[model samples]
Structure formats: structure tokens, C-alpha cells
Target: MSPSSRTPSGATEASDTPSEADETPALATIGEFGLIERVTRDRVQPPATLLGPGDDAAVVAQPDGRAVACVDVLVEGVHFRLDWSAPEDVGRKAVAANLADVAAMGAVPTGLLVGLAAPRDTPVETLEGLATGMWTEAEVVGVGLVGGDVASSPTLVVSVTALGSLEGRAPVTRDGARPGDVVAVCGRIGWAAAGLAVLTRGFRAPGVLVDAHRVPTPPYAAGPAAAHAGATAMIDVSDGLLADLGHVAADSGVRIELRRDAFAVPDRLAEVAPALGVDPIDWMLTGGEDHALAATFPAGTTLPAGFVEVGAVVEGEGVVVDGEPYAGAPGWEHFT
Candidate 1:
């Protein structure tokens, strides 16, 4: 007969208030459809998004009648850890990786589609945080999360598909680099590796490096700008500069020789690397996930904004540092 247990009609009612321990319900509590409703609600779509979530599929406009697309997948233990990063950070990193790929192709991003797999016991708030982070990164390039799907699984997995427009330009692919082309890069290179080293060593005092590992700040606009400026070949440094440049070399049948002194160690990396007993140059050479753009231009071609000369394409094969193979591991590779 207590008022707390009574409805407006004054009839007896079950308690609607949840205990403090159960305040945030698990995914099972809301069910799949409910979770979708929570994440998709109130989301704004860009003009390119013809139809967003709630439908069987999404329709995005391709202004130039050609679309560029790429996908990246992140698994819980392999790609990230909840204890090491917030859910939002993981979300941003996932979307950023795919978006970087679209940009590397010399296109402007239009929309994103995500696929999520997480345990049923996961908290609903975590998923919402993920969605929020995805939207945040998408808006950086003025795009939207057009569609996605969710499923039950033992481990959390995020797969993002980024679609883009070529805008009447041919894609700057890996095979376009020619001998005598100058090589250049357009963003931070070794910061993420330094951050990962710090995180692995049980310290986070230098937060800048740690944050880079969580959310990559790619130079999105530089992609199309490089294309307009007549870049020959381009690739995002997701798997270290040397390894990714090797892809361009092999595809174009040329050798990339880099000047060792071209990469002056940043002051922050120089200060922190000694404490971790690692060389900053190794990070610059082998670090992955920075998502910086590396491209080749004809000799004497004025480099685009934010780009600096680092090397040159030559009449040979594979990537070399100072005319020799790099001593450290090239980059990240699965199933070695």
C-alpha cells in the first residue's frame, strides 16, 4: 500500500526503480531492436545520405557517378582493450581507419556503415558511447553513419565501411609511382608507436602519445588536394611507412630510397624514447596506425600543403632506407 508501489490509478504496481547495482542494464535487457532505437535516434544525416537507418539499407548520393569504398575491422583483444581505452576511443579509431583508406584513394568521404558484434552481457551505455564516437569522427569530414548492424558474440568486433566520391578524378593508386618521382609524407608518423610503447610500459604521463594511439587524426583533406596537385602514387601509413611504401614500390616496380636525415626525431619522441629504451627513428620507420598519407610526385612538382619531401623513387625494387634495407621490423602483419 506504499505510494512508491502504487500506480496513478492507486492500484498496486511493481517497483519501476532499479537497484543501484542494476542501474545500467545489460544488452539483453533492451534487446536488439531497442538498442538500435537508442543509438539511431536523433542522428542527423548529411545531404548525401538519401535514406539512413531504420530501413533495410541506406542510399547515399554519388555526385560524380563513381563511388570509392573501403572497410576495416577491429577485434577486442587484437585491436584494442577496454581497460586501456574508453569505448568512445575504440569507436573513433575504427571509423578513422576506414575513412583514412577512402581518403588515401584521393576521394572525399560521403558516408559510413558499421557492423558491431558484442556479448549479450555488455552494457547498453557502452554501445551508445561507441555510436557517439563514430558520429563524432564522421562529422569531421561532414559525413554520416548511414547504416549498420549489430549481433551477439563472445567478443566485441567493429567493422566499418567508408564510402566516398571521386569527384571526376582518377584514384591515386599504388601502381602509379615511377622512377625519378619524389616521395613525401603529409602527417604525424611515429607518435602512435611512441604512445603504444608508453602504454605497454605501464605509464601514461605523456598523454599526447597515448591519445594518438586511441584516435588517429588523419589529414583527410590532403588526399584530394594531392590528387589535384598531380600525385602519382599514395598510401596511408597504417602499417608503418617502410612497409606501406614497399607496397607502392612493388606495385609500381620501383625502389624507394629514403634519406635517413630527412626524419628529424620530434622533441617529444626524443625525450620519451630513451626512457623506454627504444629508438624514435624505429618508431618513425615501423610504427603503424598513424594513418599519415605518403605519396610520390614528379621531381620538381610543387608538393601539396602539409607535405614534406622524404625520399625518391628509383629504378629498382622494394623499399630501402639510405639505400639499404631497414634493420627493424617493417610493419604490422597478421599470421606471419
Candidate 2:
């Protein structure tokens, strides 16, 4: 007997032959529970997951007994463009961006709760690809796909809430920077911004920059390392470097001055700047989304590997680039 003939109605049969259109589409509307199963069905759950999907809430084992949480949302047109990024890339980027926040607080990501809103016409394959990407990226931070919700909407939107454990370490917040502290960064800067520039203007560049935008590989372990090394304050560079540093400066009641020449421009960027008729320096200084960790440490403290001293904290307010006030775009704003 043929596989289809033996399979029960509404059940998808594993066979070499393509199924007929008459086959009922998997659960219409991808109802909340159905959508959840579709996304988490094949994902690998971490051992830290005390209780996974299918309840009012998921429980994660926090070895330190305290959990740190951060949430971020990605709207269809606001955060990404389907034309420029694939569904898998969108899912990974959405999850990675939020995980970077938890890492910035010097925490080990434990699990994620995702809420997806999409039109009924959205393809099940697209949703599956997104779920695959989310798990792939979450694995990088040692987290598990615990739970989520789904609903109908006009456009695709993903909201993820990431939970992390501090491992008995105190969270490194933004208000601890002080005068006489050193400012440092771990991971690339401007790569994502430059990629955006190319995507928007049709400028040609190396694939690395484009990949940077699709999936940011943040220095996940550096946050906890910096915290252990006595970092005074820390934040992930989601906004422009100067703009993000300004937050540290304002909150910590200090001034930050970045030495632009301290960091070299990647060869790929220099190669494409002229083609785009833009300065690489502008991209480096004003660009964002590299998800690099920036922190303030004691003046004489030695920065850890993967971290470079880019600036200094002084007794004042505002952030300065190379001893001068930064005069450029102020980074991403929701309303602007």
C-alpha cells in the first residue's frame, strides 16, 4: 500500500512523493499551541531547562539562584527588511540582539520566551526556518527554547524575552563608571552599519559586513569576564558608540573621550568606502549593532583578551571623540 493510502487523514506522511494540495494544511491559523509546537518541535533543549514549553511559564535552573532578564522587539520594517535578510537570519538576529543584552549584564543566558505575530498567509516553512535560526543562535549562548506565543497580525513581528543567570556575580550596570576609569570594547564596530549602508545604497562590499548585519556574533563570554575583572560599568553597543558611551557618562557622572585612531578600520571597510563615496571613519564612529561590550575599568587595569582600550573616563559629562565633541547622527531612536 502507498504511504499516503496508509496514513490517516490530516496526518503528514513521511514519503518520497510530494503530497497533494488536498492535504489539509497544518492546523489553520497556526493557532497558539500549534505554532508553539511547530517552532519548538525539533529544537534541542538545554539541561538548564527545569521545565520547558506547554505551561503557563517555563522554569529554568538558575545555579546562582537569581535570574537576569532582558526583552527586545523587532518590527517588520523598523528593525529589518525581508528583502535584505532571510527568515532564518531575521530569527537569529532578533534572538541574538536580546541575548547580547543579557550578556552585557554579565549573565549566562538560560532560556527564551518568544512571541510571534504574523499574517495568516505566512508560510509554515518560513516559521520553521525562523524557529531553527532562533535555536541555532540561542545555542551559542547556551540557552534553550523554552516557550512562546503566537497570534495574527498585519505584518511579521517578533518579541523575545531572554532569561539569564548571574552565576553569583553582581550585575554590571551603566552607572558605575567613574573618572580615572578606562573605556574598552570587545568585538567589531561599524560592520553592521556599513552593511546597512551597502544594502540601502547598492554599494558593493565584502560578505563579512553583510553577514555581520544578518547575525551578530557578540563576544558572549567577555561580559562575565569583564565583570569578574572588576569592570566599573558596562553596556552593549546597540546604539552608536559615542551615543551609548554617553549613557554611561551621564549615568556615572563622568566624561568619556575616545581615541579614534586606537582602533584600525577593517580592510574590507576601507576597500568599499570609496565605492560608496563615504568615509569609513564615519561608519566606525556612528555605526551600531555590532553588539560589542563597552566597559569602564580602573585606569591601570589590564583589559582582557578580545578587548581593546578605545577611550578614557574623565571628570565631567558628555562623550568626546578624540578630545572633541562628537558632531554626527545620534544613533537609533524609536520615534525618529
Candidate 3:
């Protein structure tokens, strides 16, 4: 930063931006422009993204006439760890979390913009790996990287902004569920949490659980599919399912009652949970970061594939399991 931009107390004197003194230093090795070039290099822009990187700003066509935009940020040590999560996993997880929001809105994620803030010491190859991961994951969902910013920070901070189109469908929000709506979930829950538990305990768990913690595969098509199937409300389970569902209940002024027996715990978790001496139900109900989709469809509506009934919207408030209050905290918190 310029001297004028520095704080009066000299607190900002330790700049995270690379210094010119070391020509071979971290980011200075590639420089800002070079880093941008490396990340955007070989990226194929989709038709919706009329213009991509290498411009003042990207221009994405909103064919549906309304753009669905959402952003999420992951902080190193807080959201992820370089020691445990590879650079690629960090990039992919960031993309998945943001895209899940677009899906939650009942929209098709047409493109993504990644805003990365990292310490200058961060290796250039690491950032490139991150870029490659972003592109790979975006391609999985048929979108491309549009544009974003790279900046300096004390630690790695990944921020992804996903742009989507609703195709004339109404944006699904938390407040639309009615008393009789059937609650269904697509994707999964608890795996990430279980993976986290394993990580925290420093014990080896199943590879799938470890992978779940590293990179979540949100059901990208489920959001639009549910919307097309006439879902009344929807949300992405970045937080725990119970926590996120509580938002739906509060917004819709209806109680969401989940039947524990109905939750489809992934088969792998059966043995894994037993070994860990932890109830899989705990993770199923309160595990966050899975990026699953929980939605409410009209009662008796033929549920689409991948969506399994978990509960119902009833006349009341908050969320409950088997008609009783859940004893644990509902979900994850940001900036707590």
C-alpha cells in the first residue's frame, strides 16, 4: 500500500504485499499479472460468460434476465488448513460452497468468480494448483471462471462469487414452506463433520470421509430440479441440516420436524461411527459444510431422484427431531 494509505499507528506497516527488495520472493517471483495469467490460462469461457478474464471486468449474459449471485469466503486455519487440505482441495471446496448457494436459489450456476487473498509468501505453483482445481470443478457443473481479484493478506482467504440463472423460475428462499410441505434432502450431511472429527483426533478414518472433508460434491442439479418439481422452499446445507432447517422454519413460520429414522446415513458412516464411538445421528443432524440441499415440496408431490424425504413442515417454529427439540446447536457460525 502507498504511504498515505497506511494507518497512523504504524499497525499496517507490515505489508503482506510482496516487496521489490527480493526479486525471487514468493508472489514477486510470478508477479500479480503473471499470477492472473497463470490462473486464467487455458480456461474456456462458456457461452453465458460473454467475457472472461483479461479485461477490466467480466461480462456474463443473463439470458434469464435475472442473475442469481452469492458469495462465500474461507479463511485459512478457520475454514481449512494447508497442512491438511491441499491447495487444490481448498480451491475446489471454495467453488463447491459458492455453487451450492446458486443451486439453493433454484438456479443454474452459469459462471464463477474467485477472489483470492493470500500472503505474499504463498507459492506460485500452489496458486496455479488452486486455479486448476477451480476450473476442473467448474467444468463438472458446466460453468467457467468469469473473473475475480487477487490480493494480499496475512493468511489464505478464498472468496468465491457464483453467478447463476433461474430460467424464469422463482428464486427459492427459506420462507416459502407451508405447514404441509414435505421436507426432502439431496446430497448428504455429517461426512464432513465426521471427517473433521477424525482430523481433530489425529486418527486415520475412511478415505471417503477424509475426502468429504477436503472436497464436497454438492448436488448441483438438485436445486433446479426441485424448483422445477415445484419446491416451496430450499436452502444449501453449508451449516448443519438442523441449523439450516431452523432458518426455513423461522422464515416460513412453520416447524420442521425430522424423523431420525428417516435420515439416510451414508453406509460408510455405519462402521466409521461405531469405531469412533460417536452416534452418526449427531453428524447427520448437526454436521456442517456438506453443501447439501434441503427443500420443501408440496405434500404428496412425487419427489425427484436423489431427494429423500426427511421430515415435514408443520404449524410451529424452529426445528425438531421426532417432534422433540434437538439438544445440540443447530449449525456453524461465521465470524464467531
Compared with the true structure, all predictions reach lDDT values of 0.86, 0.80, 0.84
Clash pairs, model 1 backbone: none
209-254, model 2: which lDDT tens digit per residue?
8888777888989998999889999999888677788788888988
Top candidate on lDDT is 1
After superposing all C-alphas onto the true structure, candidate 1 shows an RMSD in angstroms of 7.7
List candidate 2 segments past 4 Å from native: 1-30, 203-205, 330-336
lDDT of 2 at 7: 41
Error of 2 at 149 (Å): 0.5
Scored against the true structure, residue 157 in model 1 reaches a CA lDDT of 92
TM-score of each: 0.92, 0.89, 0.91
Candidate 3 local accuracy as lDDT?
0.84
On residues 1-336, what C-alpha lDDT tens digit does candidate 1 reach at each position? 001212426321122322234677766667566777888789888999998887778899999998999999999999998888898999999999988898899999999998887776788899898888999999999999988877666788999999999899999999999999999999989999999899998997599999999889999999999999999999999989988998899889899999989997889899999998888999998898999999999999999999989999999898888988877754544202
lDDT sort, best first: 1, 3, 2
How accurate locally is residue 84 in candidate 2, as Cα lDDT from 0 to 100?
A: 82
Model 3 lDDT, residue 223, Cα: 92
